[model samples]
Target: MMNLAVFASGNGSNFEAVMEAVKSGAVQGEVKLLVCDKEQAFAIERAKNHGIPTFVASPKKYSSKEAYETNVLKQLHENNVELIVLAGYMRLIGSTLLHAFEHRILNIHPSLLPAFPGLDAIGQAFDAKVKVSGVTVHYVDAGMDTGPIIAQESIYIEDGDTREDVQRKIQQVEHQLYPATIQKVIEQITRGV
Candidate 1:
């Protein structure tokens, strides 16, 4: 089975969802490592609970983004990670990681990009008063959430819906869609095997 390394910077709800998918055999891959930029992130706790190995580092410790990415690459190589999943990973991926992983990296966005492509996407969609907003799973590139789209699922924003309401709906879709899409990508990656 292909090994996966998930990158997360926060609560890691999507990370937990992917773990559930793997546990249930919905995805044919192993979660070999959890990479987190923050030492205090709740994602580390989730990884610990699941017995998944974790690599945590601070950008402040590194001289530059490349330095941080290079260190991360070492951890990925050590774990033999074949796929990189960005689940609420806040850092903007630099050219170092972009070149290293290329199309092998995938990110889940909170909105149906290229609409709200950056932070607080759920709020952006709600503030824009868009009737429809959703989730996007896409290949990660140098640009911020501008990678080629792989999959998208829409959710409607009702007139009375709060921003939190929209956030919850988007997250619900993400928890379901990210794993399903990841499974498809894994199948293609290991198609010949």
Candidate 2:
């Protein structure tokens, strides 16, 4: 099985979703590690509950972004992680990790992308009053969500839908699409496509 790592920053709902997918054999790899930037992030507890290894790399502890990412890189290398998945990982990936895992990282964003590229994407879509907004799974490039899209699934925003409603819908889609997309990516990589 391929070794995988998940980077998460908050409540870890998506992290949990991915773990569930792995458990159910919907995804064809093992989540070797859980990396979190926040010490107190609930994702750590989630990882622990599921018997997964956890690593915390707080930026404050390192002298530079590269330093922080270097530590993370060491852990990933030690675990032989082949694929890195970003699940609400708030920090922008720096060159240290980016160069180390070029085109091997994936991120699931809460918007169709090329549209609300940064934080609070669901809020951005809601504020724009768009009739349709969705989730995107893409390769993690140097730019902010500017990577080549791997897959996108759109959700219709009702006229009266609140931001919370849209967020909920987007998250539901994320939980499903992210794992399926990851599976497809793994297939492509294994096939050398």
Candidate 3:
């Protein structure tokens, strides 16, 4: 079975969705580990509940970002992680980890991509008076959210949609899209497609 190492930095709703999809056989893989940059991130507890190994390596603890990412990469290699999933992970990954994983890292961004590509994307859309905004799951490259698109689902922004409301809707799409994209990637890998 393919092994996934999920990284998260907050409530872990996306991480939970991935785990649920795996449990329901909607996603064909095993989450070997869940790593968080913050000790307070609840994803660690969620991983423990699902019997997955949990790790916390704060970037602030290291002298440089590369050093911090090195620690993360070491753990991922030790666990034989085949894929890395960034589920609400708040770090801007540097070249060190990108060189280690290359196209192996996947991130679900809260925008249709090529649009609002950074933090508080939902707020950006709301402030920009966008008509539609959704989710993007893609390969993680060197640039922040500047990777090859895997899949995108567009949801119409309502007339009075607040940032919170838009975020909730985007997150719903994220929960479904991330796992499905992972499955598709696995299928492509298996078939050499």
Candidate 4:
């Protein structure tokens, strides 16, 4: 089975979704490790609950970004991780991890991308009054959410929708689409497609 290491910095809702997908046999890999920069991040608890190994790489403890990422890299290497999934990992990936994983890193963003690239994307779409907002699963490049698109599923913004409403809708789509997209990517890699 392909080994995956998921990085998250916050609540880990997507992390939970991915774990559920693995449990239900919807995804064909093992989530060997959970990497978080925050010691108190709920993702850590989620990982523990699922019996997945957890690594906390606090940026404040490391002298530099490379140093922090090197620590993370050591964990990934030790786990034999074949794929890196960024599920709400707030920090930008440095060159060290980027070079190590290269095209193997994948990220799920809460926007159509190239439109609202950075954080608070759902809020950006809602504030901008966009009629359609969605999710994008893409390869993790050096830039923020500028990677090549792997899959995109759009959702319509209703006339009276609140920011929370839009966020909820987008998250629902993300939970389903991210795992399915990962499955497809893994299948293509295994098949040499």
RMSD of 4: 0.8
lDDT of 2 at 161: 91
Q: Over the full model, what C-alpha lDDT does candidate 3 score relative to the true structure?
A: 0.90
Clashing pairs in 4: none
Model 1 has how many clashing residue pairs?
Answer: 0
Sorted by lDDT (best first), the order is 4, 2, 1, 3
Candidate 4: regions farther than 4 A off: none
lDDT of 3 by residue, 1-193 (tens): 6899999999999999999999999889899999899999888889989999988987889999988888888899899998899999988879998888877899999998999998889888899999999999999987889999999999998897777888889988998989999989878877777
Task: Quote model 4's TM-score.
Answer: 0.98
| Model 1 C-alpha lDDT versus the unseen true structure | 0.94
Off by over 4 Å in 2: none
lDDT by residue for model 1 (1-193), tens: 7899999999999999999999999989999999999999999999999999999999989999999999999999999999999999998998888888878999999989999989999878888999999999999988899999999999999889988888899888999999999999999888842
Q: For candidate 4, give the lDDT of residue 133.
A: 89
Q: Provide the TM-score for each candidate, comma-separated.
A: 0.98, 0.98, 0.96, 0.98
Off by over 4 Å in 3: none
- In model 1, how large is the Cα lDDT of residue 87? 97
Error of 3 at 121 (Å): 0.1
lDDT of 4 at 193: 82
